[model samples]
Target: MIDPQQATPRPDAPAVEDPATMPFPLISDISAARWLLVFIIAAAIYFFHGFLVPVLAATIIAFASWPLSRSVQRALGIDRTATAALFVLVIVLFLVVPVTMALLYAFRELQQWIYWVFEVNANGAATPLWMVDLPQIGDWIDEQWMRHIGRPGAIADLVQLTSGNTIASIYRSVLAAGNVAFHLALNLLFMLIALFVFYRDGDKIAGQIDIIGARILPRRWERLSRVVPLTISATVTGMTLIAMGEGVILGIAYWIAGVPSPVTLGVITGIMALIPGGAPLCFTLVSIYLVASGSPLAGVLLFLWGAIELFIVDKTIRPVLVGGPVKMPFLPTFFGLVGGVKTMGIVGLFVGPVLMALLVAIWREWLREIRTHPQTP
Candidate 1:
């Protein structure tokens, strides 16, 4: 039997020795080497981020379509693989086909215009009246047109210069198209792969995200992850629908006004719909063409159509589609559309507003946190 003073110590009793005062175990050389290897691997990934951008973009695209894919799967009682395939097919038809056709048509028109100019120069005819009446540079254009087309020697020189410039421009455009195709191919491949993985194991992915969030912020990460994807999807869908509506309206107007190349103009109008102040350019050019071709009545009618369409579409249709879904102020939305187009080309128009929305959401969340938990004195 133990004496009362020497009774067994309770398991829950605090240790007499202080952890702070204890000597730490030395790290073994092998363990240190292993840690260094891990650090090096992480550094390599960080440094080569450029190579991973396409993959990241693919992941984002996959995530953005996840809800739609899931919805389709549920509604049709189809497997995830079939749903992903259908989604990709729809993207190809709606997005890829239109863009490809537009580029091709634009290039062909440019080439035809250049050929016409050269042919007119060779025949010693007056320059086209439309070129002579271009805004802001009409006088300068007239002077150059006379010098290049009215005189034989000058026409030869002008032809050579124009041909060289045309060739150079075409070459550059082709190179750009090649680059675009390469990047697009990579993105498409990776996106398909990502979509397959996402569809196959969506719940697993969500579980991983939750685990990561629990390990990291423990409060805000999960919320942000959900919010960001939803915001992006809403913004993209709204903008696409609005732009399509505008395109249809403008295309119908162009056709009604008997505009030559109405389809081409419609395509341009659709593309410009992605920009804040670009639609006016198409309308102005079409109007000028009408007036110079001696159809003042048609020109006036088209100009009016353009103005009415723009006002009605922006006030009624656009607000309903984009503004309603994103809950963004009109002024901010307008600026974001313009600024994004200017900075990031076509894609930025959608990206910019979404980014702004996300920022606003984060700020509001932070403000709420601060209000709820006031600092101690």
Candidate 2:
């Protein structure tokens, strides 16, 4: 006689294995196809590493300029494709042409400076009137000037003294320059092409990215979409405008202070201003040169002007423009700048701060989640 509770046995139920009693050996879940796919991707990246910079540059530029492009497209009743093409061409003029012209002008200025050196060497240059008026070390400077640079052929003698392997060094420098130039041109060509594509199809691409983001990070995707583009645009535009302003102001100062090659110096100063502490360094060095050359009033005024102007911009304007929208702190900002420069060269300068901003945002969001729903031990 069977008990009613123990009588039924289901034929459809399969045997379940407990980990403690499993009999079969474990096999890899990742198949041969996955391994082959990864290998191919890695090999492709290695082959195309040089092209990555330009592609990245194009993406960043496209992202930063998107708003303006949209505005122009709307105002002019132009298609995205035409606007993108025009925008890229404008970028070429803005970036490439100015740089090319600056180099050309600087080269000419450099030749002039060199010729001035030769002229000074031949004419037996003397101490200037202003140097004689300097207070404490004027006498020493005057004496040194008289001894070293005041005599004819002093520069020529100095040049001759340091002429070992000159031709070989020049040859090496020329070869290196040529190689660098060729690579740079290739990168520029790729960047322009990428820029045009991004301009034309950026919205479609962005929509796809949003779809992916929603799939992966549903909770955070909306916040990210709002944050990243604004931050990128602010950082790029702010830095560029400020740097140009610094250069123009300082260049005018250089001209007023009787500094030779003021335009060239201004362009160099503007470019340097994009880097932290770079503008001050340029102004300080110029001031020191002016003072050393017996132009005390000019040097003093130039230094004062630079110190005041840069202080205003750095303390008040820059943070408001760059650090305001993202609310990123000073530490991450600095780290981003230094790290980006170390890793990616000039482009990193703009890209780094944005990355740091994104990182900081993500970290804070994660912390918030942990706080709201603390995990049980």
Model 2 alpha-carbon miss at residue 279, Å: 2.1
- Among the numbered candidates, top TM-score falls to 2
Candidate 2 lDDT, tens digit per residue, 1-377? 99989977678888777989976555444666678778998999999887787887788789888988999999999999999989998988987677657666776786687667768888889898677767898899889887767898776665556775443354356446656657667877998998999999999999999998998789878977876786567767666567778987999899999998998899779867766677999999999889878788899999999999998987888777766433456678778778877877655665676677667766876788789989999
Query: Which tens-of-lDDT digit does each residue in 237-295 have in candidate 1?
Result: 55545665666677778788888667667767876665555677788788878887778
lDDT of each: 0.68, 0.79
Stretches off by above 4 angstroms in model 2 are 1-37, 107-171, 311-377
Each prediction's RMSD to truth = 7.6, 8.1
Candidate 2 at 201: error in angstroms? 0.6
Q: What TM-score does structure 1 among the candidates reach? A: 0.64
TM-score of each: 0.64, 0.68
